[model samples]
Target: MAKAVQKIKLSPSRDIPLNKLVLSQKNVRRIKAGISIEDLAEDIAHREKLLQSLYVLPILDPEGQETGMFEVPAGGRRYRALELLVKQKRLAKTAPVPCIIGDMGTEITAEEDSLAENVHRVALHPLDQFRAFQTLREQGRSEEDIAAIFFVSVNVVKQRLRLAAVSPKLLDVYAEDGMSLEQLMTFSVTGDHARQEQVWENVNKSGYDEPYQIRRVLTESTVNASDKRVRLVGLAAYEAAGGNVLHDLFEEDGGGWLQDVALLERLVAEKLRTEAEEIAAEGWKWIEVGASFPYGHDHGLRRLEGVLVDLTSEEQASLDALQAEYDALQAKFEDADELPDDVDVRFGELEEALAVFENRPDIFKPAEVSGAGVFVSIDSEGRLSVDRGYVRPEDEAPAAAFDVERGTDTSSTEGQEAGASVQRAAISVGGASTEPEEDDEDPARPLPDRLIIELTAHRTLALRNALGENPAIAFQAVLHNLVLTAFYRFTSSGSCLEIGLRTPTFPAQAPGLRESVSAKAVEARHESWKARLPKSENDLWDALTALDGGAQASLFAHCASFAVNAVYEPANRYNQGRVSAHGVRTRLDQANVLARAAGLDMVQAGWRPTVDNYLGRVTKPRILEAVREAKGESSAQLIDHLKKADMAKEAERLLDGSGWLPEPLRLADSSPSSAEPEGEAGPLPEFLAGEEDSANGSDEHPQQLDAAE
Candidate 1:
């Protein structure tokens, strides 16, 4: 042997009287954390014993004589618990508590022993604890019972049980540090073992291992219950039709997701069809049924004038009584901070009764009904949105009578000539004319397209300047547009701007968009305007004119925001000879300039690159490009080794506060130093000032897809 080995001395344990034990000054704990002493004491008393032994030292006198007393060093919580039990008379003062008696020698101080005892012990691994909970469950212990036994919450117990319910292979992967606890939790969202393994296989390859990505790829086919279609077809009815719903216990799922999208769509279609059939009975020539209609579905169509169907005498009497009761209730509670429950319920009942009277169908003339159709679609709130009395161009009545001498004009050439005569007459003043009318702008030919464009362009600029200078007028103009679009079903375009506020039907928007910063800002601004608006239509004029300049400007900006649609529709589709591809590009370029002048920063507007939003949805190269742009190459290199899914996640985190935006959101030609190519410069070069022109094709944005074709 190299040297003689030293032997270690050990401490002995013994039962000490509860009264004989005194609190140790050397014990290091000072802050109260974790379980409270009172609860610990109750737990100890309920079990009739402590789970851990207390560390103690015998009290010695100055003369080296022994005293029948002890001081605790480690396990202070257990000591306090025993003391509390004794004070509560649950334990006799003379009751004995088992403890380890340290060697009385001064070689090792009480403080060192106490610190070592508390610090050296290892806590149980979470996976092990989860498995143990599973074992307890298998042994017939209820979740509540297990929670009581372990001093934890029932939800905590259930969460642990859910983790245990995951496949054993995944648990092994978790135990071996092959996956994170959060990633393991993602597997718990669905119970199919095969799907879990499949997701794991995909996650294990290269870099696609984020928890959210796992959930997305696993449930890509499922439809969220919050989807307007699902909300339209009630969840109860969907489930009654044998549809399955999967819930996320860990996150705010907003009522969870429906697994069968096909079933949901079928149910939605069936409901919509039923509603359409009921509306068809209202004598419309035809009914167009859909979950959503294109933004400009009624474009170029003539809207029929109709009267609101009068309420029956009984309905009118009910409505009057409800209004009276509602007025009385409002007066009674006018000064209250909150309404009483019964009164609130009564008000809701009154509102329902009133709505029955308010939503009466239109009474269109039989002649108009024969030529007009209805657009039946769901609104944003999942309510039935019936757009009535739109007469398509093909359905418009003939302008002039055709003398169809039934057998005399039977030749194909004569039939064609008749159609040509009808077409030519359709353009004239409702009569046969060999010569153009005297009031024609040009009898020789129609105005040149380029000249018309230039004229309209000048008019557009003038209107813009006028609208910008007079905020009050601008507000009224936009309000008029909104009211006409909402109530009249169709409107003649009188304003040069051609304002139309289309309700967005984003079929593939990122989750939680309604709660986004931009969305919230819009909602707040709308509510503020709504509050300031006059209650009576007759007071609207005074109310709007009374507003100060600053208030008027703010309201104007809010209203004008709805008219900003930079979205690109293909000329091949919705242009209908009005807008061209070149026109779309020109409009977008001008819109970008306006946005820059307004200092509109998408980031400031509350758009951020998130996995659910931008990252997870794009291609790997796009994700990497975004990362490389937002962060430098060095930062991008850090995540370059990851797979597509993993890279998107890491990229999202790295770019969180970096103020990064996708190509669709970025302001083209943002910097003054940027150069423009020859011939592609802005037509109004004076407006360029310091801004640069974008390359010929660089001005197009990705969000240019048509809302409707």
Candidate 2:
């Protein structure tokens, strides 16, 4: 057979002119168009400084010929940087850059190799590396191979790959200006050119060139856009129009104009009412018609259609203005406070008048407080009292309460008969005194005790009036009071009535008592329950029952506590079903347990043998002898006998026969006993003690055994 032909390995290298380094538009990756000239200038400056020390440039060949020159495999930036330097007169035009060249067959492999060689070896920016990696990927390279070549995690490679999908404009911007990888990454994820431009404009306007500020604005703006894109766009446009959009939208006006929806509603209703009255006086009914009536029915009355013409021009104008104003106000007040009492009452009066005119009793009632401040009352007895803090006249009847006389039994016939006779007499003699003496001596007529409490009857009215005058002050005061009341009732010892006082001094003293009491109550209940349980139990059953209950409760509480801790604590590594150890030693122990259970020999598995394990107790000589036996040596016994000798002596003897002993070992003396014994039937050589002896000759014969047996 003919001998195999040896292939020649070429150590490839190349040099190319800067002018030939054209960006391959066909192979060029598409990216965002956001790059600016200023950024490009900065990138050129940085790249120039980086490529200044380069020695040679890698060359490429489309064909296998060594003289052929093609596109550069890598160093595109370096070449561009040099060109920029030459243009800027920083370097001579004739200066050569170092590069490695390869042919078409090697182009793909060379590009990959170049990426791997430069990815970590050089200090290029992450984004630059990502771009290079992305270029290779577009050329049909796999992520695994890229990761392996770059010695990076697959996830890292994948993350870098995302840069390829980034807008070409943005990548160009990064290449030219050297923007932060973080900002670029954020912009990549958002993929909103308009928003990105807005962010850029904002940063530039703010004179903030820091990447962090840019990143912060991008992140916050993107998040804001998620829910408020339309509003944000409108606001942006409004701002651009010099309308002070932010202030107009967020700042509160003092007049109730911006505070109450009912005010606007009432204004509209008033105008409508005036028109209605005029129409009524003209012996015609008022009606709402046309496209404005979306329900496809006359809002007022079909018979009132002709009455619409009765409205004077000025009146009609006012009505139209009111309607327009109502629409605008309604839109503004979509989230504004509801109708106030005065507005509600006025609306009710208007609706009632309209209802009377229309012959319909079911006019809309403006919203009202169903339950106002506490209502108190007293009977014929002159007693002073209050309910929910409201004091009422003594003679006024309690609308929500009633009284029953004591000592009136219906179980006995005479009592029942007397009760029936009294009722019949009272009904027959209405307004007539039954018994003057009994009425005078009745103890049920005693005066009731006085009550003190907060009053909420006119709260809404006051708030409305305050809002009308100065909404800012009114809103502030209301919010302050609400906060104070919350603090008082939720954190106070007194009831809501006592906590309603607005005085600063008194409120300050009582503030938080309710909270204190609630906390104490909880603690007290827990302590009391704990105290009620047995201190100790002798019986396992009782103990177990108590433990079961306590443990179950503890487990629930612990789980809840753990959840809370996971949210608030920084060191909570536990997640889902995975258990974590806090210390390295514990983790090692866990690893060891897993290794042992998997039928793996810990020592053989590369685990350091510990004194606590059997492997650690085995002598080196016996191990060596066993190793020799496992190698299928015919003279296993001789190897074991040799191992029994002093390790240093045996090593010295073997090295001496091979004439390779070190000076120290060669200088050492070896007695006959230390050496192999001659014709020994009593005991073999010490080195052979652990090995099996064959039936061949001993050291006395000094004969070699066959290799197989």
Candidate 3:
């Protein structure tokens, strides 16, 4: 059976004193019992300040039994304010307070009404709003409905719902003090209460010094994983233990945060072991060839050893043949003097001599006789005919008529003395025939067929110096001009010039010569020289017009010549102003304007501004004042002396005391006079300028003084 609903009449007034009005103890306990009275008072004051025109009313029962009264829905704060006013004795005890009342219902319906009424009229804190949303969702409300109720996007509702799952402890902090929703969402992804609690503790402990510190600590500690709970708990433990577990196991003594040192050491040791194994498998060897010529030259000993080990039979046979040939040559040379005197000896005679020499090599060998020896054929008469031999001192001198041919002495001293007399006769005859030999040698002296035109040492040094001074210019003048000209003549003339008489091509073929010269010329013209031109019109003009008209024309001509030689020729004459006569004229015009503005001493005076002087009008005093003001300073001036006065004391006094002027402005709070008066106005004192008498007593008000006092 359904109980009949009570009909309660609501008052039209919006402001009601909750103290004066009767309310059910049950409703009072549900609404205001747990709330701090001081907080209620503050809220009431705030609401009253926000809405100056406000009122309240009462509620009644349907039995006409006056169970309760309902105030207009906007009067909650007003009722609280009225209660405060009554408590403070601002309103008389008998004075009526306005209110409207309504019937009671279930807690949910009451909460719905409260939320609906207050949602549009007041701004709730975001966390409170999110919690409200969660409560609605728990009551079987869809995301869309929750969003509509709160007048927010569905995504915003969903986001708030997600945040609701954040650790209750962290949520409590969020409620008491504001925190970023993004940070809460990030923590939620971990889904670990302990981890979230740790994060919250760290953040709170940091006193919100830097927002990124929390995220940085978390990201460095954790990895992304689907089982966020286990991962988060592990991460929390890791961070809480100061990230030193691995260090404890691997390090002898406690090392701070360097737990991976053992891992790094293990890796390096493994790499070294691998390298050692490879070296062993590859059979590396070191050879020390001590103290030899061509020092430190290895001569590829290892390669040589390999080749010796791998030699084939054919190579061995070839080596044997080479040894045999060497032996045969040695045998023939053993007694070369005993061999044939005929210059045109056959292969057969050479072989026979070689074989005989090989058989009895000692017989053909010539005795090492000193001085001179004679090979002579003697007849029955005491006359001797000589073969090839040295002259001896004991031998009689040859007759003056005997034509003796001198021959090289191959024997020792005894043989040389035997041939000395013949040699002296030969020398004397040669001297007598010197005139004929000169005439015969004269034909051999026709100007050398190949002239070796070598430069003198000094001339070569000078040429090298010139090249070093400017290789580009020297190369162009010497190689490009002379060598190219000679090459052109040779190629076009169709003449078969001798190789020695041909011009040298070495200089022309030198690397980087032509390209370097071109690059240097282009760079000098564009960068080094052209960069000297004035960047501004005034500077350009000043440079040009420094001379008289005749002098200017001469200067212009010089400039034009330089420009034509530098800018025009290299650039193909396409951009003439770069170094042209007209460019000189433009520079002259600029100079004239500059000279007129800055007087004839234009070089010293510099250029004048065409625009008005905006810089001069900005007040120096105002700028100084602005700086002083930024530094929290004040100043006064002695007008007659035109000097600053010491106002530090006066400024301090103004800051400390309140009189005709209020305290200096502050950033965080408004003027003190703007706050609501907590009590009734106190009685005025006689010392006050406008006040004549005290309405209460001396305790009610303190004395105010005139400026003269």
Highest TM-score model number: 1
lDDT for model 3: 0.34
The prediction achieving the highest lDDT against the true structure is 1
What does candidate 1's lDDT look like per residue over 1-709, in tens digits?
A: 5997999767888898888999999998877877888889878977998788889998989997779899998889888888888788888998888988988876889999988987898989999999999999999999999998888999889889998989889999999999999889888877888889888997677445556567766776676677777778899999999999877767666787788877876787678767766666565556666666533346467777678888779878888888999899899999999988988899898887787678777788755665567776677666777788888777664631122322222234433432332222211111111222232222244333322232222222223333444466556656656676677663323222347543222222233333455555555656777888976679988998998989878766665655544443345455568556666666556556555555566666566776655565555666666666666555656676676656765676667677776655556865222222433322211111222321111111111111122
Instruction: Using TM-score as the measure, name the better of candidate 1 and candidate 3.
Output: 1
Candidate 2 off by > 4 Å: 1-128, 135-145, 178-189, 221-709
TM-score of each: 0.58, 0.20, 0.19
lDDT, candidate 3, 292-312, per-residue tens: 111111111211111113335
lDDT for model 2: 0.34
Over 4 Å off in model 3, which ranges? 1-125, 178-186, 203-209, 221-709
Per-residue CA lDDT of model 2 for 268-296, tens digit only, reads 23433333333222211112211011110
- Residue 387's lDDT in candidate 2: 18
Ranking of all predicted structures according to TM-score, beginning with the best and ending with the worst = 1, 2, 3
In model 2, how many backbone clashes occur?
Answer: 44
The lowest-lDDT stretch of 10 consecutive residues in candidate 2 is 448-457
User: How well does candidate 2 match the true structure, expressed as C-alpha RMSD?
Assistant: 37.8
